[model samples]
Target: MASNISYKCPTCGAEIFWSAEKGCFDCIYCGDTFTLEQMKEAGAVVDQPIDEQKVEHAEEIVDGEYTQTTDGTVSKDLVKYSCSHCGAEIITDRSTAATICVYCGNAVIMSEQIIADFAPDYVIPFKVQKNKVMEAFKEFSKKPLTPKDFDCDKVVDKMQGVYIPFWLYSGKCDGRIEGEGINKKTYRRGDYEITEKRIHDIMRDGTVNFEMVPVDGSAKTEDAAMDSIEPYDFKDLVKFTPAYLSGFLAERFDEDADKCFPRAQERIENTTRSELEDSAAYDELDIKSYQKKTTIEKTEYAMLPTWLLYTTYKEEKFFFAMNGQTGKFIGNLPISKVKLVLYSLLGGIGGTVVGALLGMILG
Candidate 1:
C-alpha cells in the first residue's frame, strides 16, 4: 500500500482542502489559504492518471471491487489513501484518480501520489454552486411529463461535480463540390404569365478551418450526453492547475488524443459540405458528389466542468447532465405516459381550432 499524500498548512502543520468559493486551498484548522503556485512551492504536485494499459501490474477493475489476500501482500501498482475524518482505507486501482471518501463525506486529494501525462493543458473551473444545481434540478422536474418522485432524496442526493476529460482538435478542411440546381424566372406578359426554368451545374471549392473542436476522452461518460451540453465558452479557460480540483472530482483521459480524430473529422467534413451548398442560390438543388480532405493542426487535452445526476428507475440507471460552467441541462428521463397522452389530445384539439380559424379567414 502506498502512503497517503496530504497538503499540510505551512504555518500550522494542519491538513487543508480546496475551496471552490475562494478559488484556493485552505486549512480548516489554522485558516491559512494557499494558491496553486503556493501549494506547489509547499511540495504539492499535479495529480495524474495511472492507466492500467501503461502499468503492467495494475489491471483495470470496476469500482467497489478489490483483490483480497490472505497473507496481505499487495500489488505495487495499487495505492491507498486514508480519510482523516473517518479513517477508512480508500483503495484505488493504480488508475491514479481519487474522489470523495465513501467513509466520511469529504473530498480526498492524494497529493503524494505520482501524477502522469493525462494532465490537462487547460481547465474550466466550476461556476455553478451546489444550491443552484439543486434549484435547477427542481425546476427541471417541474416538466409535465417527468416522473413524480424525481425530487426524492434517493434520486436527488447523488448529484456530483466532475471535471470531465476532453480532447481539443483544430484543423482545416479543403474540398470541392459539384452538384445540379435549378434557376427559375417568372414575369408577367400582358394577360399571360411567363415562366422559365433553367438547369445549371454548380461547382464550389473552398478551405474551411475549425478550432477547438472538443471530443470527450473518458470512456465512462456517454458521448451524446456530453455533446448535448456543449458550447462551453472557452473565454474563461485558464492554465490547468490542481488547485481548481479542491472539492470536485476529475478523471484523466482513458483514451489517446489521436483516437478522438475520427469524430472531429466527420464534424468538419459535414460542416464543409454545408458551407459549399450555401454558396449557391437555387430554387431546387440536388447534390451529386462532394469530396473533402482534412488536415488536423493541433490536439490538446483539457478538463471541463459538469454536474451529473444519477438515478435508478426499475433497477436501471438513468443520468442527467448539466454544464457546470454554462448551465445547459440534458437527461434521458422517464416519461409520464398519462401526461403524454393528455398533451397529445390537447395538441390535436389546438391544431384543429387553428386550422378552422385559418379557413374562415381565407375563405
Candidate 2:
C-alpha cells in the first residue's frame, strides 16, 4: 500500500539526488546534470494544488477525488510507503512532510505530503556545509575558562542538519498607556538645600507594527534555544519547493500559527514599551494602566535550517545548536573541578602574601 518516490537519472537507473556540493540535482551514474527547474519541466517535481495548468495536462481531478483502497496505497490521514530498494514499509504521519527510509537509508519523498492548506510558503536552506560544523564548535569552545575535560571533537563530528519548523507572524499594535510620573529638582540656598518635587499624570497612545516575528512551531525544539540565535536573514528566504529539501530533512508544523500569537504579543509589547520610554524625555515613568490591541496580519509556515548536536557527560545530557545560515553556536560547557581547585589555591596564596606585607607595613 506504499509508493516508491525515488528520483532517478533518465539515462541510467541509478538514483540521482540533490547534491549540496553541486547545488543541483546530479546523477552519479551516467553523469547527467539537471536543475530543479529542469526537473519541474521534465515532470519529475510536482507541487500540490497543481499550480501549473498553463503547461497543459490531459485531465485534472480535485484533491478530494483521489481515493485510497483497502491496500492503503493512498490516503489523506495516514500513509504507508515502500522503499524502492528493499520494498520495506515506510510509515509517515499526517504532518510529517518528508523523511528518509530507516530500513534502506534511501530518501522517501511523499507524493501527497503537501496538500492545499498544509503547504509551506518559504524555505531557508542550509548555507553551512558538513565540514564547517567542527570549525564552529571549536570557535565556541575557545573561551579562557572553558573546562579542560570537555571534548569538542567527538560532539562536532556527529552534528545533524534538521530543518526546524517555525511560524512567522506579523501584527499591528495599538497601545494606550497611562501612568504617574515624578519630576524632582534640588537647589542649594545659602547653607541649606531645598528640593522641589512635581508629580504629574502622563498618558501616551501609539501604534507599533511588527513584521515577521517568529515563534518555533515544533514542540520538540526548545523555545529559548531557538530565540537565542536571533534574526534569520529574510533576504535569502525562498519560495517553498520540495526540490530544495532534496538533501535535507524537514518536518511539517505541528503547532498552528494562532497558537503562537500570545507569545508574539507579549514580546511586541515589551519592545514597544522600551521604544516608547527611549523616545520620551520623562525623568521617571511608571506605567499603571496599559491597553494593547493586537491584530495578526500574516502567518507563514516554513522550514528553517539548523544544526543540532547532543552530548552526554557525567550522565547528564547537553544540547548545542547553531544557526545553519549564520553559523552562530550556543551551548554551555561543563566546568572542570580540578581547574577550579587549582585556581582557588593560587588565589588563597596570593591573598596570604598580600596580607603579610600589609601587617609589616602597619608594624
Candidate 3:
C-alpha cells in the first residue's frame, strides 16, 4: 500500500519539524525526537504551497529558498527551529524535535542562526534504482586485476540513497592564447646532419558555451567520487519539488552561494582552457609559454541531481553515487589484499608457464 509518510517522533506523539539553526528536528510540544522525514511521514506537519498572488517571484524562485514574510500561509513557508542539544542551524517546522546533525550526527534542535536561501531550481529523480546500483558495483568489482572479494554482495547491499546538492553553471567564454612552436628537420649533406628550428606566432581564440557544468556542495562527498558518475542528464530536470525528495535523504547546501561560486568559476575556466587548446594545432610544440584570457558573461547555479551511498568496510566508511537522471555509477571499491596478491601470483605463474610451453613447442 502506498501512503504518504509523516514526520513524527516515534517515542512521543509530537510533530518534529527540521531546524537548520539547531541542525535537527525539534518538538515544541513534548520535546520529542525525530528527523524531518520521520515527521513528514507522520502527518504532523503539512507544507502548503506558496500563493502566486502574494510574492512577485513566487514561481521564479526555488522552493525552500525564499519566503515572503507577508504571504498568509502558502503551500510552502520558511520553517525554522533549533536543537537544544547542539547549537546548529536547522530548517524545518517547529514541530520537529530531532535530526542528525550535518556537522555531527548528534541530535540537534533548531538554532537562532538558521536562515533561508532560494530552493533548488531543478531536481533529477532517482532513475537508477537501488538494485541496479548494487549490480553496477558488483560489475565494477569484477574487472580484471580487481580483488576477488571486491564483488562481495554484502558490500553492494550497504549502499544507501542520499540526495547530494550540486550547482551547475552555463556560460560562454571568449578566449585568447599566445604560444610558440618549434619545427625540426633533418638533412644529410656530405654525411653531415643539419637541424633547423622555426618559431611561429600562434594566436587562438573562440567562443565555447558549456551547459550544466556540475559542482558538488556537500563536503561529505569527494570530487573524484562525484566525477566518476559523469554525464548527468540535465535535460530532464524538473522544477524542484519536495515530493521528488521522497524515500531518500535530502541534504541542504552546506556551502553558501558565495562559497560555491569559485567552483563554478574553476569549472568554466578549465573548460575554456581545454576549448582553446583543442582549437589550436601545433607540432613539436614545447609550449615554451602560454597565456589565456577568458570572459564569462553569464552564470547560474543549477541543482544537478545525484544519489549517494555511504557504506563501511572493515570499519572504514566509503561512498558511492549514481547520477539520478543518467544512472551513471560512481564510487570506489575496496580491493582485498589477500585476494589481490593471490590473483597476481596466479596470473604471473600462468603467464610464465604459457610462455615456456610455446617456446618448447616452437623449438
Query: Candidate 2: where are CA atoms >4 Å away?
Result: 1-81, 85-96, 101-105, 110-113, 142-151, 182-197, 347-363
User: Candidate 3, after superposition: displacement of residue 277 in Å?
Assistant: 2.7
| Top candidate (lDDT) | 1
Pairwise TM-score winner, candidates 1 and 2:
1
Give candidates' CA RMSD values in order.
8.0, 10.7, 14.0
Error of 1 at 249 (Å): 1.6
Question: If candidate 1 were superposed on the true structure by all CA atoms, what would the RMSD be?
Answer: 8.0
Residue-by-residue lDDT tens digits, candidate 1, 14-121:
656665556667787888888777876777653433343433222234444442211122434445556655777666644334466666655664443224565578
Q: Which is the leading candidate under TM-score?
A: 1
Ranking by TM-score: 1, 2, 3
What clash pairs does model 1 have?
Answer: none
lDDT of 3 by residue, 227-317 (tens): 6676777665766544444334555555655576677677677777667776656555544444544344444443454555555556655
Can you write out model 2's per-residue Cα lDDT over 14-93, one digit (the tens) per residue? 66666644556778878887776776677674333434332121122224333222111244454455565787755554
